[model samples]
Target: MDEKLSKLVQDRVGGAQPVCLFAYDLDRLTEHVRTVVASLPPRCRMFYAMKANSGERLLRALAPLVAGFEVASGGELAKARAVGGQIPVIFGGPAKTPAEIEQALRQDVTRLHAESVLELHRISEVATRLGRIAEVLLRVNLAGPFPTATLAMAGRPTQFGIAEELLPEAVDTARRLPGIRLAGFHLHSLSNNLSAPAHLELLDFYRRTVRQWEREFRLEVEVLNAGGGIGVNYADLDEQFDWAHFARGLPAVVDAFPEHCREIDFECGRYLVADCGRYVVEVLDIKRNHGVDFVLVRGGTHHFRLPVSWQHSHPFTVVPVEDWPSSAPRPELRDAAVTVVGELCTPKDVLAREAPVSRVRAGDVLVFSHAGAYGWEISHHDFLSHPHPEHVYYGDSA
Candidate 1:
C-alpha cells in the first residue's frame, strides 16, 4: 500500500465491526489528474468521462484540470455545469430525450454525439425549436480488425453508435437539417483497453477513417473523439495502463491527423481516478465452512460491485485490529487462504476468493485497492436496505 493510503486507513478509517467506508485522497487525485493533463500535447484534449465516478467532489476537483467533462445524460450535464460552469462539456448517449437535446443546446454543449439518424432528426427538431444551430458529431461503430478489449462497443453488436454503412445517409441528413452542423466523427471503439501500443494503433485507425470520411463527404472535420478506453489493472497493480508511454506516443498519432481537425479528444474515466480511493470494510465474522475458510465483511457487492461485475477477485489487504470488546474468544486465520465475503445472504457476495491472508480476526478491516472508479457509482446501495457506507475524504474536495 502507498504510505499515505496506509496512514489514512489506519488513522482515519479505523473502527470496530460493522464499518463500511469509502476513503478518498483528494490531493492525490488532483496531482494525478494534473500530471495527466500536462502530459498531453496542445492539440490533444483530455475530457473526464463523468460516468465513471460523478461525485460532486470529484467533478469539482477534475473540472479545472481536465479540458472538460464528457457527460452522457441531463443529470451529468447539470452536475458538470454546476461544478465548473465555464468548462466545456460534450454530450453522448444512445438515447437522448427531446428535453435533453434542448437542455444541451441551452447549456451550450460543445458537441452532441448522435448515435443514430433518428437521433440526428431529434436533435435537429429540438434545435429548430430552440432556434439554435446545434453542433453535432456522428458517432461511428466501425467494422474493426482490432484488439480485444475488456468490453467491445464497436467491431461487435452493441447499441452504442451508428453502423459503418449508414454514415453517408446520416451525414447527408445532418447537412440537410435546418439547425445542425456536423462537427466531426466520434469513434469510441472499446472499453478498458490496457495496451499503449495497441491504443496508438487504434488512434491511427481513427485518423485514417476520419480522413476518408472527410474526403468522401466533402465535410470539414473539426473534432475527432477517440473515446475513453484506457484501463486499470486490478489483477496486478504494477501492470497498470502505461499512460506515460501512451502520452509520449500519442503526439505522433495526433500529428498525422487531418490538418482541418481542431482537437483530438481523449475522454478517460477509469484511468483518471482508479488509484485514489479505497473501499474499507470491517470483518463481521470468521468461519471455516466445508473445509474452506471464509472471512465475512460488513459490506458486500451492494456497496462495491466492481469485483463481481468484472468477474475478478479484487485485491485487498487485511488490516489487523488487536482490540476485542467481546467476551468470547477471537477466532483468527493463520497463514490460510481465506475467501472473503460480504454481509449479503447470497453465495455470490464473494470479494476475494481463496486469497492468502497472514492473519484476519473478526474485528479486523479489509481495504480494497484500485476502487476509486466504478466503486460506489455503479453499486446498488439500496439493495437489502442496509445502511450506506460513509464517504470520508482526506482533503476538502468539493
Candidate 2:
C-alpha cells in the first residue's frame, strides 16, 4: 500500500464510528485510464462501460479521459450524459424497452446495439415514431470453440445476442428498416478473458467474420463494437492482463483487417476500474471453528460480493491497528489459515476462505483490493438492511 492509502486506512480505523469503507484512489485510476487510452491504436476507440463502477466521482474523473461511455440502461445513459456530456455514448443491453429506446434517441446516443431481430424492428419503430434514424450494430452470438473466459456470454445458446445463423436475416431486416441504419456488428461474447493472445485471436475472428458478412450482404460496415471482456487477475496479484503486450499487438491486428475500414470500439468495464478501489472492513471478532481459524468482519458479501461470486479468495492485505479497546485477551492468529467472513446471517457470506493471514485481530482492517468494478454496484446492499459502507474518494473532495 502507498503512503496515502495507508494513512487513509489508518485514519478510518481510528475514526469515531468503526464503519466499512470503499476508498478509491482517483490518482491511480486516472493514470491507469490515461495509460490505456495512450496505448491503444488510433483506429481503436475506448469507451468506459458504465456498469463497472458508476460512482459520480469515478465517472466524472474518467469522463475527460475516455473516448466515450457505453451504457446498458436508461439510468446508466442518464448518468453517462450527466457526467460525460457531449462525449459519445453507445447504448447496449440484452433487453431494452421501447420507452428506453425513445429516451436514448432523445438523449442523442451515438449508437445502439441490437440484441435480437425483434429488437431491431423495435428500434426502427421507435426511431420512426421519433422521426430520427437510429444508428445500430447487430450484436452477433458467434458459434465456436470460443476463447476461455470466466463467464462466456456467447459461443453457446444465450439470450444475449442474435445467433450466428440468424444474423443474415437480421441484417436484411436492418437494411430494410426505414428508421434504422446498420452501422456494423457488436461481437462481445465473453467476460474475464485473461489471455492477451486469446483476446487478439477473438478480434481477428471478429474482423474476418465482419468481412465475410459485408461481402455476403454487400453492406458498408462503419463500426465494429468489439465488446469488452478484458480480464483482471484477482487471484494472482502479480499476474495481470498484459496491456502493453495487447497494445503492441493491436496495430498488427488492425493492419490485418485492411479490407474492413470499420472503427473498432472497446467498451471495457471491469478492467478499467477494478484496480483503483479497495474494500476496507474492520475485523470484529477472531474465533476458531472445528480447528479452522475464522476472522469475522463488520461487512460481508452484501458490501463486496465479487469474491463470493467468483469463489476465489480475494487477495487482501492486513492493516494493523495499534490500539485495542477491549481489556480482554484479544485473540490473534499468526501466519495461520483463516476464513474471512462477514456479519451476515447466511453461511454464504464468506469472502476469503482458508487464506493465509499474518497476525489478524479484532480492530485490524482487511483491505480487499481490485474492487472498484462490480464491487458496490453489483452487491445486494439491502440484503439485511445493514448500514451502507462509506464511499471515500482520494485526490478529490467527496
Score candidate 2 by lDDT. 0.90
lDDT by residue (22-65, candidate 2, tens digit) is: 98999889999999999988679999999988998999899889
Model 1: lowest-lDDT 10 consecutive positions: 8-17
- Show pairs that collide, candidate 1: none
Measured over all alpha carbons after superposition, the RMSD of each candidate to the real structure, in angstroms, is 1.7, 1.3
What are the lDDT scores of the predictions, listed in order? 0.88, 0.90
**lDDT of residue 127 for candidate 2:** 95
lDDT of 1 by residue, 1-398 (tens): 56665676666434443668887888889999999999998789999999899988888888889999999999999998888677899999899999999999999998899999999999999999889999998999999977878899999899989999998899999999989998888999999999999999999988888888888988889989999999998888889888899889988888897677988899999999888889998888899999999999989899999898998889999887777788998889899999989888889988888888888998888999878899898998988898899887776553
Q: State the weakest 10-residue window (summed lDDT) of model 2.
A: 254-263
